[model samples]
Target chain A: MPKIAVVTSAFFIASLISVPMGPTSVHLLLPGIVGVLLGPAAFLSIAVGLILQCFLFQFGGITALGANALMMGVPALICAALFRVLQNGDRRRVVWSGALAGGLGTALAAIFLALFLATAGDNFFAVAKLALAAHVPVVIIETLVSAMVVSFLFRVKPELLSLPRREDAVAVKEKLEAEAKESESSS
Target chain B: MNTALSWPESLLVLAVLLAPLLLPLLYFILYRRGRREGLVAPIVSLAEMAGGDSFFHRWHTGLKVGCLLITCFLFVTLRTIPGCLAGLAIAALAVTVSGLSWRRSLARLAAMSGFLTLLIVMLPFSGVMQADEKSFSLAFLPAALPLRLSGLHTASLIVFKAMAIALLMEPMLATASLAATLRGFRQIGVPVALTQMILLCHRYIFVFQQEAARMWRGMRVRGFTARGDWASLTAIGNFLGMLFVSSFERTQRVYEAMLCRGFTGEMPEIGSEPIKRHDIGKAVFWLILAVAPLVAERFLHDFTQFFHK
Candidate 1:
């Protein structure tokens, strides 16, 4: 229960801190940063964060919430996976990986947005193209921000990056100990 | 070939289509610059209003949510101007039935004015093959830039569809407690664990926001202001790192506390009333009301065809 509460709270609070990008309604959606920090749990966090955004902030509608979640959550999950594969504990490597993940996530989301719009009909193809074009600056901005956030976390709290591995080791250890105790009792 | 709109038409388009969305931007700027109220004001306000007692508040969360879902489908798929207008009227009717003020509902639309404004301004110029006759090629511009009238019409339609749903959301979302709403989601076949997580996440968001704000304030006192430099970026990054470290440790403690209280893998269900028959009836009635525009559009189109015959 506490695990559920804390993970949910961290991501939700993270999303609540959205900074509106100048004249446009496009706000900073920090899915990449959340993904880098939360690891495998990034998808769940993104989905929950989006739901909160839909209901509270009116950032997206309830009906389209699932599509929005899929768009944002998939990138976060991919970012988490990429971080795990790419990082070798070097600060520069982690920063680069974070930047890549952040930019990639936004780009994929823009594509997803276009695809959703395209589903409206053939006439929306142009609008979809424009949407993707508009997100280019967002991609760059997110890359910079994600890099900073990931680098900072790596330097200050390297443990966050390796949480999944740590948990897996603990679980394996617990299973091994239990198996050994059972064998001894049988003997 | 004649695509140019006179000055009067351009002005009319700007006034009728583009102006209303600016009000919310004004509100957003005032809020951001004035009280420094932090970012959670909108979230907090909607959450508070969801607990209000009204007709909508009386309906079961599941029923209201179900209706909202249907309305979304209907509005998003709707293609005609009259259909979209009908959808907006239905949304307004729902808001009235919920006993919420039009002003409050409009304010909800206002929150999204920024987004709507963007669509109105950008979609016409998105480079879709414009219907030549319908293009609003402005004569006033030296280059005679053609604003695709069809694109503008589509953008307007999309905005109206969005506004209709946006207005309807207040009744659907704000009319119940968050717990019941989550429970409704669960009842509607969403995983129990997922709903539980959403609730937990919502509670923690407030917790973490306060902590983050305090830390931010502390940094400010120490002369930290974000600038476009590596130092500023690094400082911001460190702040985020510290926040994660502190929060991660807190999660461990929170978990330990839960275990001490005899928590297992599953959360205990929060109390909610069973769905009554009337709840189902109410949901169906509202569903019909919400989808009336689609039906009206189909009938109206056929009706017009019969006249031509």
Candidate 2:
């Protein structure tokens, strides 16, 4: 649970560092990155981000929050699964797979948004279509951004991208603690 | 407020009257030389307002949460312009009565203007045309365009409904402390774990934003200008990766500190007074009044029709 809290917080913070890209500010909505890092916990992480986005930024609405969560979460789960399947130990493989997952996650979210809007009534069909079309550029941009991020992590901290098993985290923590104790005694 | 204007004219009047509410946004945009709080002002102000000794702050958190949820429901179902206006007025009244500045609420509405503008632009051309209505065609477009005045009406209704909901949120959120509000969620049968996680996640956002600002300053001092080129992208990517790494280490340290302090997985419940009968009565009364427009739209349709006539 503590680890969960940390990972969610990190992702939430990382998503906030928006850069001015032309007229629009682009922040990393790393649902795909989070999905890959956290796997099944992707849904929870995405939900937390969406909730904060709602209250803090008013990006998504309270009424559509559940719908937004499902939209982003489903794709996140898919991307996480895809990342695992497509990943090997190769750097290029990691980047390409990450890029694919990132782009597809956004595309899937757009589809979900369209579906939600479509459900409102026939009158929303045009808005739905326009919304989906609007996300095409986002897909491309997320692909590039995710690729860069994946490449960076691959070079710097590969361990962070590894699937986090509960037993593994516990074992790792225990080992680190033991090592720290031994170092202190020697010193 | 003009009774003699047609529906569209009324909308135009409303838009004109509401235009000045967007000046803060314009000031924020063009000047870009102000406080530049970036969402913190509202969060901090709301938190401070939550501690105020007002009627709303004194209301049972559960009742406020319940009514907020109901208002969200009513927002979606509301179809008529009058209903939306009534809902908007109710929200405005709530904000005024609670003694919170209307600026944040207005700013929120302004924040949504871009999307609303998009809706206005796109929706008018997308609707299926009625047989009785004349279609407007553009020389630049194919003959299949379904552009009609009715689509504008639907789009406008959506815009108004959204504004009403957004206006209502400021009061709903500020009425109680965030923890108390989450506790209200727990009282209403929303999972305690989920609410707790939201609270934790929300807390760290402020922490991270502060970190991010410092990091941005470091970059800016080193002359990092954002551009649509590879260099800018790479710099941002590196910054993000660095943020994540530091945040991850911080998280571990935080967890260790919590463990040292005998941390449990459960969040300690904040002390809250039990709901009194009078509180329940007040909640019921306000909630009924909140939904009065909806009831009017439904059961009292004939009465509204008499006015329309």
Candidate 3:
């Protein structure tokens, strides 16, 4: 099991650096994308990368590291799940999924932040409203970016698309089929 | 003790203003200390590409978005009834003409308007309760401390104060966040190639989401639903793993393709034309506009004191 401290720190750094940008937003998206394709292990890798960025750049506040991590990480996880559900050969679907995921992810982060602020005795509704408002444009920008990237992937490397899905399924299928064929031949 | 403003009031105002500036500094100095260990080789080409005009355009868009929030805060604080009405009209117009999906916008507008109205209505009620003249003391607190206030007026004052503080803080925070990101990038010596890669990654999030959605619809048609079993969990696991691998591989291929196109590490420079003297003058003009009211209010009270003497 990965240490909670490491994961928390990684999330803190990623949120600080990633949350400010319009498109090409980083942090949880990277880990989320990684986790989607690479399994839960990828979370650790991305988390490490985030930790690196945070320490070097001082982007996100340490006090809010756990909250930040949960914000970005949870969304990334959702996006990954969405990617799985929406995985198809169609380019448009990929784009839409990515866009929706980006927007939803951002909104979720904003809500989480708002709630955190509220619990801290900041006016809950006001803070949440502000966060949601600030994130609207960001979600739009991220959506566009997500669509473009997914489209690009579809065009160039179709095999990479199948890798994560293929890892567990294809192997089992092939092995099972091979065993069946061997038994038939013996019979 | 001789200051024109009471000490507590001054302290409150200072605390509100200082929050934005101090928060980022704290983030940088303390939180960033442990982040340097995973520094990868800076991808120079990616950085160069990201430095281009397109990248800056995105940054500019972000700045404008920040400005919009500031405008909202200002509108809330400078609550001239006409201004508020005008803002409501504009929001209505935006709802009608934005050419985007109306459902979300309408929902947001309704929520915001409702909240504002609620706050407005509740103020008088709260005010009545808090206006009682009373003296109270908590353990370990000074017994002579006076805490007299009208609830409604105080609530109204707080609402306006919060709006004012937000107006002042929003832009500052946006600028600080942006500057910090840029400075951090520069300081860490991120390679141009990596910068470009990062930008591309940012861009593709939207792209892949659409792709994912289509895939999901197809799966739904094929009768795949999670009914809380091991199979569902496995299916979910596979889906996530696949998305990540695909995205990463796609990024690698993108780099390869860029290499084939004679990609250099320099992004095209993009900025609004050099700041015109008029623009600077206008900015200065706004700064004065923002400060003038407060300054006048201060001096007018002093002038009244002098005349009375």
DockQ of each: 0.36, 0.40, 0.04
For residues A94-131, what per-residue lDDT tens digits would candidate 1 score against the true structure? 78998888788888889889998888776677767878
Clashing residue pairs for model 1: A8-B201, B50-B174
RMSD of 3: 17.2
Q: What residue pairs clash in candidate 2, if any at all? A: none
lDDT of 1 by residue, B1-309 (tens): 445668898677767667756667655555445655443343464566665677688888877777787787889888777889889888888788787655556566777786677778767665546343455666555435567666677787878898888888778777777788877777778888778877777777778888888887887789876554567656765666676778788999888887898888778876877788988888888887877888887878764342222
Clashes of each: 2, 0, 67
TM-score, candidate number 3? 0.36
DockQ leader? 2
- Give the per-residue lDDT digits (tens) of candidate 3, residues B48-73: 12232321223333333333334444
The TM-scores of all predictions, comma-separated, are 0.84, 0.84, 0.36
> Which runs of model 1 end up more than 4 angstroms from their true locations?
A1-5, A18-27, A118-126, A163-187, B1-3, B23-42, B101-107, B127-133, B142-144, B302-309
Better of 2 and 3 by lDDT: 2
